[model samples]
Target: MEMQRIMEFPDRIMDKRPRKKPRLTWDMHPPPQPQPPIPPPKVLPTTYHNQEVVNGVAPNHAYPSLFFRGLTRNGSPPWRPDDKDGHYVFAVGDSLTPRYRIIGKMGEGTFGQVLECFDNEKKEAVAIKVVRSINKYREAAMIEIDVLMRLARHDINGARCVQIRNWFDYRNHICIVFEKLGPSLYDFLRKNSYRSFPIDLVREFGRQLLESVAFMHDLCLIHTDLKPENILLVSSEFIKVPDYKFLSRAMKDGSYFKNLPKSSAIKLIDFGSTTFQHQDHSYVVSTRHYRAPEVILGIGWNYPCDLWSVGCILVELCSGEALFQTHENLEHLAMMERVLGPLPPHMIVRADRRADKYFRRGTRLGWPDSSTSRESMRAVWKLHRLPNLIMQHVDHSAGDLIDLLQRLLRYDPAERIKAKEALRHPFFSRDPKRHGYPL
Candidate 1:
């Protein structure tokens, strides 16, 4: 469906020009197939006004526990693997406690499985993320609880965090309740088959995401994994129209909003990589593709690492493809240089010391002149030969997005622009008319 009302603002205070979408043209491609008119997912009533409705029912069977499977892996099946259906199959009727009822399985990960569930009291469909690996589940559950609690307490510009309906800790499992937003950003991009992202939509998504990260930064928390997979849409309606006036005021003054509605806002998930502060801290941790240079090199880093991930997220969102995806350390560095220009002249002491030992196998061992040259870096980036991918999905040339991306992905943590500053760059603040999306 066409976006009903694109956010528009009348303010024209800035003389800056909106960054142009690259002039490059190509073979015209048709829009995606008509997505079957599936009804949007049900929305539960919040403490906010104008609540949306949802539809779904709970299953009558019990959800089988993974405890027995874990035991079997160590030896033989703890119980009979034979059931009436076949070689023992589980159903959803098992998890009917008080507030939650298992409906069906939504997805699974290394530590846990997510179930499409029904919140009995709220009468709303929800996604219940149950940690099956009981031992490893604690860490995930703790992080999820902390992040959700923090978001529930804080207020920010046109941004929304997840709401914890309730949480339960079974003897062998921990189930955290959350309002089930439909699909994740990863799912959306995949459905599109990685092509033709709307420029305005990406900017809008980026702005909201940064605002959320900024809020987390203030709380001294870092979302180590800020990729599309960890970002879930709250509702299609919530993100369509941004509050331009509210966001403008926030940029001008570091103010916060009260009783914010989380309509189209994104709910950050998967804090498995999140690190909390110690009395005195040092070192780094985060995922590979979206990881900041300092973190990758094993140097000390803080919240800014999340901003770096945010930068990568913006590129991916706009292009519907990953920007830096090399698996090898040297190759990854080369890709970074191609997109970000170069590594800084000065390196973090910890990172440098580690690189001296770990990075010795390749030309990266050489300092400055001994290292990979600029031409080689460009060649490595070109080797991917992703021009059509960039043009078709990103709506811009690699160079154009690179210019904007460099500000957020800088090697020097200090040099990396703050979220607020990045939002004001010509990319967003350039045009107050068409580009001035409502907050």
Candidate 2:
């Protein structure tokens, strides 16, 4: 069971994953049977007797797993004090149950906070996501749990996404235990003062990211949000790399330096927004910085939206800054055009009514208009093209990286490269020194 828990993480990343079709869901309950060519289960109304329900998530013939109301079976709050946000109030050495003891706090979000804990029975350190006792958040946690279970069941080798250790209803909060992981890519970059990673490191990170996307796609799921913040380094270890740009200063005072991950192993996380290909995609998805052009234009989207996000993430990893840093839709579109060339005539023509205001008659964008402030226009102008941006930060394999970014960031979703194809791009296969993990 020890070996079964987690071993051979390298094999989990299958480089030759078949180019297959995949989709995912957020409102979606449980995924279909594992593997591609998946056939949908019939939705014949039915019920079960003497059913073993975990947190009211029971096995049903029709929906199979969508029948749960919330994290608790009776929809009743447990006998425990909660914060103003309905988040569980926990502390170090507090007992989550008779079995798990809180060690420290890992992080927090809108849903709830994640606590580092020691599993008494398993005797291992784990991270538990203590969901808010609120009904809506609890329900969302159930969906996420189902999705994680599906991924874990299918990905027997522990590949692509993070692995779940266990889960339960603790004091009415959906306590999900995950194999503890290190800091997120976003956190690492912030701690490093937003210094860019070496090209060799970027290549390894890119490959694993594509493989994870390919795995999710192959399973018919689309992780709507793909950003550095959602990607975690498997280990927290790092080594100091002297800043060559400031080598003289470093030689004298040792002030400027960069921390590079000792290992390139990573895992994808945050599946609360995952949606199936069959589900409606009109509503906006993805973080503002990583949002695809199609999502902004309200022209519907699919797997390619994830590809667009991958392009942004790769750029951020290489340059240590988000590709698009605007909150306004028009400015976001403007940034897209400024960096990746034009927005494509067809994309502008196909823009939904809301997006039309950002465009003029032809392919020209409505910029420098009175509504657009001077600061906004200047920011857009300051951005370099895809090639120039990559070349500015990366010293080697810039050409291959640029070409891959072009395909991944294509304004036309139909023309965007698939995750499987992106994994095979010359960038990954170019140099032996660039492909493998950091030594």
Candidate 3:
């Protein structure tokens, strides 16, 4: 069956440049103000497992708990609790609104804590993200809730994005309930000792991701943060819930499950950094490794930025490591140019005033006359080509995959392939069923 095509924005709309921001500041708006603290919620005893204890605290207790799960002996999980100073004080067996029963801490982020809970009314498990009582976090939580609500209104290519079960204010904290999902792609990769996924698996994940992104872009929403950590696995019959003791052992051994299923669906999560396509977003929105060139250059970005991130993610999935691994902007740009070739002169010229620090006049190269010596700069630029790099890491030689990656990684946002267009690419057109695989 042919996939339904999502309408694309007009060329004029896609080509239109965003309004210029102040040359001095990269932020589009001022940071949120701090608000008076709200009193903590009162916890009531529930009839659940009263003997269960989490972090030395009995059930229905409230105290800051430490939950750390390492990916490998040397690798750490992305979400680590701040034991020295943390605001997440919810405990297992605690009841929220008398409908949801907190089971255990799933994860934690900058703005909130995620808890695995059971929904009494629905008789199913759900993930609840409880924002900190701080006013700034509360506001961000509301924005995320709004985005999730809008996204849940539609299904893309018969696959639904992560659903928002419900949201409400509980004890001065904004709590968002989402459908339960398994570990993130980051966790999956880490569990397998950073081994690259099979080609067919990558194709399945890539297709769904493109559909999800296209669905969001169709509604003018841009997920500024797109990475392995944010892509979660949809729970399946093959998935088995690991007990806390088993998880602790798996963290040390770097093996979560004995054998991973042949296929599993995925969903995009974490909408805190999401915004309208037309909004002027902060230049430092995406993670450093997956950030788009336009974002690094401070050129205003749009929906195409998300596609750029998808390109980075696809490469990481194939290589089991970031395509560009650097915290410094100049070094990051150097890494990108090494693989993708130099940025277009026109793009460099249109960059913000900060562009002067990296690029030289009448040159496509960067890091001009800075602390780094010319010899070192030349050496860095002489890195491996894209094809050679991919061939060395990825086990497959499918030309279609390479073609799609090239289009998605274009330096010029206007020239970069849109998510909807990517869905129609020959890479996804191949029938997985013919290969004896169900996607």
Candidate 4:
């Protein structure tokens, strides 16, 4: 028993060896203590080369070079290259076809930019619409040109449409020349703080608009996009627009006009969306606020569509806001019901399939059950609020104006008054002794 405990020890215990600890090396030095993150490089402030004060403030950072490239040392027109990339670059002082000298940008639109220019040959100021050099815009511009050309051939004395002086292709763009005009009716409204135009003014505008629209319809052309913005004053004397920026600032101020002019000559402009009477147009042609019910119902529309738009325009002139003030089709339909009474059952039944979602089945006049529909119903119930609203902004003697609006705004296109007939409406035939013959 004393022969030592080693005699009985297992062979596995003798074979086992002691483990050794891992040694630390320079390569494994705790990832170099994660050296403090290097600070980011500071961005230098951008300095504009032609920086100058404009309206007592620094020029727009987006267009600092706009002033430097478009003027000569003596502040005169300067010629620039005609082409940029695949499009035309119309500079402030560029020569267009050696006939007109660019003065400045008058305004811009979906099809093109209108430039105020001096017609060197004609010895008068004119407007040149430089259409964007794209296929769709070019096609639209050509259609406008064709319409204007046809219009010019008529040469009726009282035609209230703009005349196209000339048109030619330059640098892949269709450049159309027109008589220089004043601000738009929309601008006039803006200058007047969105206040309703005087009753006399409203009548005169309505007459002019009717005359123009009637003339267009007679010629089998429909102005699909008629609005305040497309109606322009015939003279700049009424509103002095020194430059686009000045006009913009004046519009923003809302006090541009201290007193309303007794009258201003207006001409219908922008025929890019005009169509032939026989053509089937897209339902979404007119501006949403002024769109006709027939168009909204997806039923076929005709010349009467323009009459509906005229009603809307007249309402805006008298109320300082859109008659329907809605974009959604259902809400628009609801507002129409509130103001004009529910659409006729025949109209609702014959409407495009899309309209069923707005109407209740088997009901002569019922809106859907929804939050918006309920709110619209409540609005209809409280429509008495409109009397005070109308009185506050509209200084017009109501007289036969309401009747004329109703005739023009009827849901049935056939029931809508024709432009020629509207010209003879009692609204326009007010007693000369009382209203002074509305210009």
Which is the better candidate, 2 or 3, if ranked by lDDT?
Answer: 2
Candidate 1 lDDT over 274-363, as tens digits, reads 666442334655556787888767667787888888887887776556777655566666577655555664562446555654343332
Give lDDT tens digits, candidate 2, residues 1-439. Answer: 0111111111211222121111111112221222222232333222111122233233333323323333222212224578899988865555565456666677777888887777765777777888898889978887787677778767666757888777777666777778777778876776566677888888889999999999999989999989887898887667776678767563434435567777789999888788877776647998889999999988889999999999999998998888888878988888888888777888888888888888777567887678888888888999998889998998768888899999999999999999999888888887754555433
Off by over 4 Å in 2: 1-80, 250-253, 434-439
lDDT of each: 0.54, 0.73, 0.66, 0.65
lDDT of 3 by residue, 48-121 (tens): 11112222222222322112221221111122242433354655555665567666676767776787777766
Candidate 3 clashing pairs? Answer: none
Error of model 4, residue 52, in angstroms = 41
| lDDT for 244 (candidate 1) | 34
Which structure among the candidates has the greatest lDDT? 2
Q: Which candidate is the best by TM-score?
A: 2
**Deviating ranges (above 4 Å) for candidate 4:** 1-87, 239-257, 362-396, 432-439
lDDT of 4 by residue, 1-439 (tens): 0111101111211211111111111111111111232333332221112222222222222322211222112222233343443345666555664556676666766666777777665677777888887778877877777777667766445258887776666555677788776667765555444555667778888999999999999999999888887887665333222222225564554333333443467899989899998877876788887889888888788899999899888887876666666557777777777677768888877878776666777434445455565656665455423334345544455647877888888999989999999999987887655855433
lDDT score of residue 21 within candidate 1: 20
Provide TM-scores for the models: 0.65, 0.81, 0.73, 0.72
Q: How many clashes (backbone atoms < 3 Å, residues ≥3 apart in a chain or on different chains) does model 1 have? A: 18
TM-score of 2: 0.81
lDDT of 3 at 222: 92
lDDT of 4 at 182: 65
